[model samples]
Target: MSDPLLDVENLRVSFATRTGIIEAVRGISFTLGRERLGIVGESGSGKSMTGRAILRLIRPPGRVEADHITMHGEDILAASEARMRQLRGGRVSMIMQDPKFSLNPVMTVGQQLIDSLRAHEKLARSECRQRAIAMLDEVAIRDPERVMGLYPHEVSGGMGQRIMIAMMLLPGPEILIADEPTSALDVSVQLQVLDIMDQLVKNRGMGLIFISHDLNLVAKFCDRIAVMYAGRIVECCKASELHKAQHPYTLGLLNAVPDLEHPRPRLEVLQRDPAWREALSVSARS
Candidate 1:
């Protein structure tokens, strides 16, 4: 079989606080092919940190260490700042959790998208504007031209998120690491955004690392699911078989999801096992 588009091994992230080293992401590894791979877990499970570490976005006071992170055979961990810049948006783009925070408040949406496009490629202003509008339309934005002229604050949360998606896709990245891309949107808009991502990933054959805390949603959207807990991936399995996940944490997470059909008065609380922190394990059900 061919190699995966993104290969991560023994990835670790930690912060040097006044107290001591706080390991946010323990040694965990995974590979991404041209398919949708979901990282699902509760909050503070190192889901977003893993995604950011893959993109080399960790800031100072925070350290990211990895055995090796290879993107298309290039060692990402050793890439220069310039090379990392080229890879960041050109080869790997990320749609953050909230658009209001990611988008430039003072800049017009069109200008931001055009600037991003121009940053990666040399395109004329008129051509860039046209492409930006087209990209906005591709994300299901209504009246792309008008919306493009508006500022980030002028748009709704859902529209802003879509605009962010449009900007990210304009670079033609081979991989997209979306960290809770739809958590801020309403249910209707959430579905639309998810559909946009689903169609785009399938059509472009891009490798997707969807980072979210919603197990059921991830199971539905991704081809495979990686269950993270206490900074470690305890299980990796086909999304269809997530119900039969073996790890105690995975099982706990599954049971914690409130069921509408069965109408349970109270959902089961997730119990943490002491041994989870001592060892990192990856299941092979996928």
Candidate 2:
């Protein structure tokens, strides 16, 4: 009933390679309120690129053009660098796919977390450290003190993810873009991490954009699902309606997943159609 927290319209991104210009994300549109929205597709499907483009994190050699990208009532695509910096990690934060690559290897976990909080808020040293430790505890870290002093390399993958979650949540962002937040963890740990994220997002009433290749996980954790193929979204519907998806590509993806109840000799492979890609590009431009 209220205005969406985030709105993206006709978003496009492309990379200039030696061979040719490769379009990573075709013009796509979506909106998010205080609800979970899942974008699921295989690697190179432009899922991660879409998330990065929303934050305007694309670097040189890559170009991002959007008709509109707004947060609340502010125009993000038109914002100045200084304003964008203030928006990033303050009003909108992202939890990268790999904590090992994202975290500062040389710094202590507590130091990194404290720095993140201090970047957005003017707080005393003692207050920042206290808030950092409290956030770690909130993410279900058992021994916050020990974990805080330890370097990123010393902690397990699951622990690293929880720390990253704490850091992202510390700023109290209105929207969180989490790209495969639990892809590297074990099954048990994966569920635990997702549970922590789920609980925190709901508690804070923040809109979430969950990007992953796991259809089953998305169906369970998200309220709505967006199925991406090539560089565009082919189907967007409620998670429960995924089974009844009308698009051929969506159906193919669902059929490809393994069904435990009905054991099969082999999983079905996706059948690509160049025509589909061409049509999507045309539609994107229109």
Candidate 3:
């Protein structure tokens, strides 16, 4: 078989605090082909940090150490800044959790979209604008012309997310990392955004790393699921196999969610286990 599209190994990220070091990611490893992979865990499980580390977006006072990080045969961890720039957005794009922070408030949506296309491809102004508009339409946004002219703040949360998707798609990336892509929107709008993303990823044959805390959503959307706990992946299996997960942490997480069919007196709570932490440390070291 051919090599995976993206390969990560023994990836670790930590922040240096006054007290000591806070390990955000504890040597997790995974490989992605042209398929959807979901990273699920509660908040502070290092899901977002893992995604950010892959993109080399970790800020100062934080340290990232990895055994290997390769994308399509290229050594991403060793790439120069200029080369990394070419890879980021052009070959691998990320859609942030919130459009409010990702999009420029002052810039018109059209300008940002067009700029994204122009940065990757040398196209005529007319061609760029046309492609930008087409992308907006592809993401299920009607009246692309009017919406393109409006600033980010002028549009609804769902629309802004669609625009962000358009911009990310404009780059024709091989891998897309969506971190809590629909967390800021209503349930109705969230489904719409996810459907658009699902269609695009399928049509383009791109590998997707979907990071979310919603296990139910992950089970429905992803091919495989990785359950993270305390900065490490405690379980990795096919989405359908999640119910049979062997890890205690995974079982705890699965049990915590309420079951609609069987009404319960109270919701199940997660029980902390020190053995899980010890096992995680051993796994990281190994």
Q: Please report the TM-score between candidate 3 and the true structure.
A: 0.96
TM-score of 2: 0.96
Q: For residues 77-186, could you state the per-residue lDDT of candidate 3 as single tens digits?
A: 89998998888899999999999999999999999999888888899989999989888889999999999899998999999898998898897999999999999999
Our model 3 lands, by Cα RMSD against the true structure, at 2.2
Q: How far does residue 119 in candidate 2 sit from its true spot (Å)?
A: 0.5
Alpha carbon deviation, residue 193, candidate 2 (Å): 0.9
- Candidate 2, 210-240: lDDT as tens digits: 9999999999999999888888987788897
RMSD to truth, every model: 1.3, 2.3, 2.2
Query: What overall lDDT, based on C-alpha atoms, would model 3 receive against the true structure?
Result: 0.88
Candidate 1 residue spans exceeding 4 A from truth: 283-286
Question: What's model 1's lDDT at 110?
Answer: 86
Q: Highest TM-score, which number?
A: 1
lDDT per residue (tens digit) for residues 1-286 in model 1: 1678888888999999999999999988888889999999889989999999998999989999989999999999999999999998899999999998899888999889999999999989999999998999898988999997899989999988899889999989999999999888788998999999999999999999998888889999999999888888889988998878888888888888888889788888876778988865573233
